[model samples]
Target: MLQIDCPWCGPRDETEFSYGGEAHIVRPSDPDATSDEAWADYLFMRTNPRGRHAEQWCHAHGCRRWFNVVRDTVSYRIEAVYRIGGQGPGGSHDPA
Candidate 1:
């Protein structure tokens, strides 16, 4: 079982949280005006990077708060945990 360190609740069992998906996915400003293809892309597309990926995680069984986690996809090792609304260690917005 992997242990995830929650920014608000510290380290906890991975079972206590839910993977929200790749971070920094910006919602369309005018969804209704967007084309079908664009809408579908937003709904289904994601980057499958090999290293250092940023993602969102919700501490469902603990604090119920969401935060950003910088992890390695290849090794499944967490590099950093950060709170929402703040720039991650890499100096980028933790968007989702």
Candidate 2:
């Protein structure tokens, strides 16, 4: 029963959203020059941190828009919520 704060739609039930996986993933600047391992890493590698994690979530049932959320993996407590292009409370990556 997580109450997610949608940037455009306010707080809403967790059921209204879809988990969009880990945030702050950077795409290759030159895909043509990128190696296969690098491309594979981009497609597969993810940092599964145990403490606070930054992630993307989409408000599917409400606004149909995607946003970012900072949450504690152990306690499931939301630290902050921001739009897709915005930065989390303590995050450095822009996610845009």
Cα lDDT, all candidates: 0.88, 0.88
**TM-scores across all candidates?**
0.88, 0.92
> Worst 10-residue stretch by lDDT in candidate 2?
87-96
**Residue 8, model 1: Cα distance from true site in angstroms:** 1.3
**Model 2 spans > 4 angstroms off:** none
TM-score for model 2?
Answer: 0.92
Residues 10-96 of candidate 1 have per-residue lDDT tens digits of 889999999999887888899999999999999999998999999999999998998888999989999888888778876978444
- Winning model by TM-score: 2
**Residue 12 in model 1: lDDT:** 93
Candidate 1: C-alpha lDDT:
0.88
